[model samples]
Target chain A: MTLSADGSRAGRSPRRGLSMRAGRRLWLAIFLAPAVVLFAAFVTYPILSALAYSLYSWEGIGRSGFAGVGNFIRLFTTFPYPRLLANAFGNNVIVFVLTMLVQNLTGLGLALLLARNPWGARAYRAIFFLPVTLSLVIVGFLWALFLNPVFGVVNKTLGIVGLGALARPWLGEPGIALVTLTLINAWRWLGFPTIVFLAGINAVPEDYLEAARLDGASEWDVTRRIIFPLLAPAVTIIVILTFIGSFNWFELPYVVQGVSGAPNRATDVLGLLFYRTAFGEVDTGLQDIGVGSAIAVLMFIMLVTVSTVGAVFLRRREVEMG
Target chain B: MRRLCTAMIAVALLATFFPASVLGQEPAKLSFWSWRTEDKWVYDRMIRLFQQRNPGIKIEFIPFRAPEYATILSTGLTAGRGPDIIHLRAYGGLETFAAPGFIAPLDFEQVPELKRFPLQTIAGARSRKDGRIYGVPFATQTLVIFYNKKIFAQHNLTVPKTWEQFITVMRTLKDKGVVPLANGGKEGWTLEVLSGVIAPNFYGGTTFFEAVTRGQTTFRESAYTGALAKMLELRPYMPTGFMGVDYATMQQMFINEQAAMFIGGSWEIGFFKAQNKNLDFGVFPGPTERADQIPWVSSYADGNYGINAKTANMEAALKFIRFTATLEFGQMFTDLLAQMSAVPGVVVKNPQLQQVQAMNRKATPYIMLVGFRWQAPTGSTLLQSALQGMMAGTLTPAQVGEEVTRGLSSWVDAFRGR
Candidate 1:
């Protein structure tokens, strides 16, 4: 309350008002202290520590010394051999692109069908979403057994259906391993996008659809014209999320394919590459923390840069709710 | 009812927070870590015996999956909080731990039984830097072929002593619509085993590896490339999706009699017996490249026990290490664990392990991996990746040989720097 006595006092001596403002700021600082401290301890500290490690030449064991940019140089420029840093990055890109294409389209299709409220709609939704709830490790093992070329149900089923020729080592083939893993990733995450899209569709006012139908517009036309534009907010969120998730793909591949991204490193993504270099893998048998940190810093930069650009691009497409 | 619920909550909270202090008794304890998930019972039984022998010392046995153990153990050790006693994988792997001084060197007086161990057995756990033994040998395992005897008999096949005869047997088995060799190419170690078993014959066994280390020679020479070719040569006789088969899948195929032969370590015997007791299996040294040559098997001491240098419970750790060296421990290891003991005088009664023990005349250090043989641990990694590439038909044998040489060059540089 700006009472005449307070206003006149503030004008007479601004120090009185300044001290009050400082007292208010102190309480604000006190309120935010826990969150600020936690952020510094866990997130800020580790990132900065890893960044420091990237600047040194350190094996997991032994005395670490400064390497300047040597670790980064070796990671970026190692050649003649196929264990190049570029291979992992390229594989990560493929995983991202393939997952976006497969996951988004399938999810959208399922959401559209189910949003009609057909018979057993909730049951179908629940069934499709079941895989998302399973632990990645369990999913990996189940899929590994399912796709086992020798005794796998997939191969056995193929053989029974006179499609024996189509049966092959799905996980073992270098050509198809990454593609298969990306598809499996999409399958596992199908529920998230479906639910998001369904919510967006339902939020579209029924009056908008009814008016279109009364005006003789078909269901498909109404959906493309009215429902989709209103669902733009969810679309943007889903696209950005899919972009981030794809770049971070690790657990499913690591669990199913083992540490080496087996079948000749065909499924070797950047995350696996970083882990193998840093922690040491049974197959790679390397524990070069410096190189691993360098890989991580590089991946961090790429992820941030691409994620920011993706968010901006996706956000630009979002339409205002009418 | 509300007061009763509140009272119950208060009691639970008090118990959770102050139980240990209130109980007023704290036993001296030691924690042990190992990657032997399948052999957990053996360790539990040994721990029971250890606790019985030392009533005051409470030992906790923690097990990790084999592939994940190195990362978990190394990380814990780096944080200065690893277990008091660590079960280390023979030589090559323990070098990483030793390099950082995560493991402590044994005190000769504390474990006098160290004097009884052969220098060769002690050598596996010895630090390459200080030449001090950091751990005691627990057991030794060998890499060799385990074949289904009944299947071999059905095909009227005798054990092949030469590469040519071996190829004939593999081809015959393949022709008869049976998997001759259950190849688990998905794992690099298995491929390494197959290649290591064959590499020795052409490269003059362990002698050649030592000579290469002394000279710092590039493996680009055909001596190594030739062995890679031999590894590739058996691909036709392997399962259709040999690259897809994993360690477990291959084991099942072998046990089920779908496959006649499996190239693996003697460590597989316990698992094989438990999985299919009805299956008849036999052991053989990997065949030689030439008929006149003697086949060399890759043998290495396994399950070497090391102590955490930073451990507070050093006395208990020393006690555990010393006990592992005793004949009583050796007897228990063999009888209960079904493994060959490294305690010089003790032996395992398993016929296959005994056969392998008797065949030590042709045995050599499993050089490809054991840190003592390969200058860099990554030499095995390079070999694994190169072998995988070759199997995938992406690289030639000579290219793989070059990769191996290149990978070891870093180790050479490190040695020269020293």
Candidate 2:
């Protein structure tokens, strides 16, 4: 409800105070120009530029003849051979699934316990949120050091506990590298979902819970009947954020495994591949920009589609809670 | 008032036009980019000395983390913006800088002091595209096996000359409850280092490499097969679950004597000395199967510097490159960085390096970015993946050979297709 200069409703004074309104328009333009310019420069420009590059075959920063969808063709046409595109997409899915199962559930469990006022819950919250403040690179590096087979605390501790035989390379093996990275990512970001869920649980009307408890409801029953349903909105947000993050995952894997995604590219993610194809590596010396741009376009489309669908599906489950 | 305003505007325009001249003979500032964080002192000393010798020029030093340097530099260059001078990796990395005109060719006549460096020592500094030397070569490194002399003595082992002898020595060390090798497998670079030492000896050195480049030979050939087989032979002697160990941990293992030998480049010597001053370590060329085969030591040019072609400070950049060859800079590098200078007359501070110098006749190309630049996965990637597979037991020597051969053929096809 916008007020006019006459102190009337908007429609009554739509054409009133023209000079002053012009001044107001000028001020609005002045205020918004910086943000508008920034959005155009940083976000809109790069996305448009990537879309443009996807149409052509370029080596990027060098001679670029029109390849015209050859990059896309190569990915789709690798029939008899294993498509790197499929492998990378599959890896992202695995990360997303594992994270949703392990990290989210863990976060929810922690949030529920904290809401129940467990012993030293405040201290435990701080401890849990500690890793969130750290940069992903630092987390990756510290985790890599711990997972190192030689002179690493993890393996050494395992040895001290007489589980020396169980001490194996956590990050180097193909069967476990992706899972390890997912777990590390979960460890770093678990606090976000945990806090969100906790906030949602707090916002749930205590009157409903109290009434249920007076009716001889268990704490678990109150939580299931009232608190959990109210947290649907938080669940929707977490699911969408997790989906986006899983596809865009790069830094941790890169810091730990390097650009090659070594041990036979066992840890190769789409982000790493996109970087390698676009810029090349110190060793490869061949930058295929066309393929890299194609990958970027695919990643953007996939992330948007999945996140939108996920949000829509999750939003449908969000009860009115009235 | 009008006259005064006009006079002030005139002075301001003049000031903008001639800032340096107005400021009483200020030095011409040049920006220098480097990633050697720990050895910042070496560059600081070099800059001070260079500044003293050339008083008219001042260089602003900017340091970045080495792992991120390549990406940052590439982005800067692509943006048509960068520092005046940059530190580049040797061989294939330098080629990209030179090939696409990111680095300008140096005027050799202006800096003839660079002649002190052996052409082969800085061969990696020469660009593959233009066949021109892009910058001054500062440091030299050779990859060799550094073994614990105390451990060798305890096991009553001698340096092996043949494959059987090497196997026997490894067996003796393994049976004595010592980790036989300390090679990091997590990053894939150490495996590359391992390939560098063994591949040249078995593959007829440079001759076979040239043939393979010309498409007359494939990696599936017996030379690569045999070398790769030998690569597999040494895997069992490593610590259990060695495939996941990284360089730092491997270094720790060697320092603690948990591992009897560390197969790394000369860069680790300083770290080794720092960790255990009394540690008795000896450098040896890696062992081979045939007694008659001369083992090849992997040599690379270090601290390779290049000038940005579009820089505003050409004269200052040239002076910097020239100063890299001076005895003063060489000594500073050798003393502070604990690495050898390829500048001919530089003093060798570490006596252990002298042992490596004696085996120079057996020196070979540090095989990376050499044979695989023409294809998709790349030569370094091919070898790294092959080595990783061999270690994991997922790939046999024959399978490794096939993988490399496939990469080579792809390169050949792409080359021909292009």
Best by lDDT: 1
C-alpha RMSD for every candidate: 4.5, 4.4
- Name model 1 segments beyond 4 Å from true: A1-41, A78-83, A210-221, B1-27, B371-377, B414-418
Write the residue-wise lDDT of candidate 2 on B1-418 in tens digits: 9999999999999888988745769887888888777667668778987899899989877888876677788788878888898887676667666776888887569678867678776676787666888888877788888899999999889987776887798899999888988876776778888877756777777777667677676777787787767777777887677889877788888998889988888888877988888888988887765898777777767647789999988988888878886888778777776777777887776777777777667776665554455334567766786688787777787877776666555436633322
Model 2 DockQ vs. reference: 0.41
TM-score per candidate: 0.89, 0.88
Q: DockQ, per-model, please?
A: 0.39, 0.41
Compose the digit string of candidate 1's lDDT tens values, residues A35-63.
99999998789888888988987644554
DockQ winner: 2
Full-model lDDT for every candidate: 0.80, 0.78
Clashing pairs in 1: B92-B370, B92-B371
TM-score of chain B of each: 0.91, 0.89
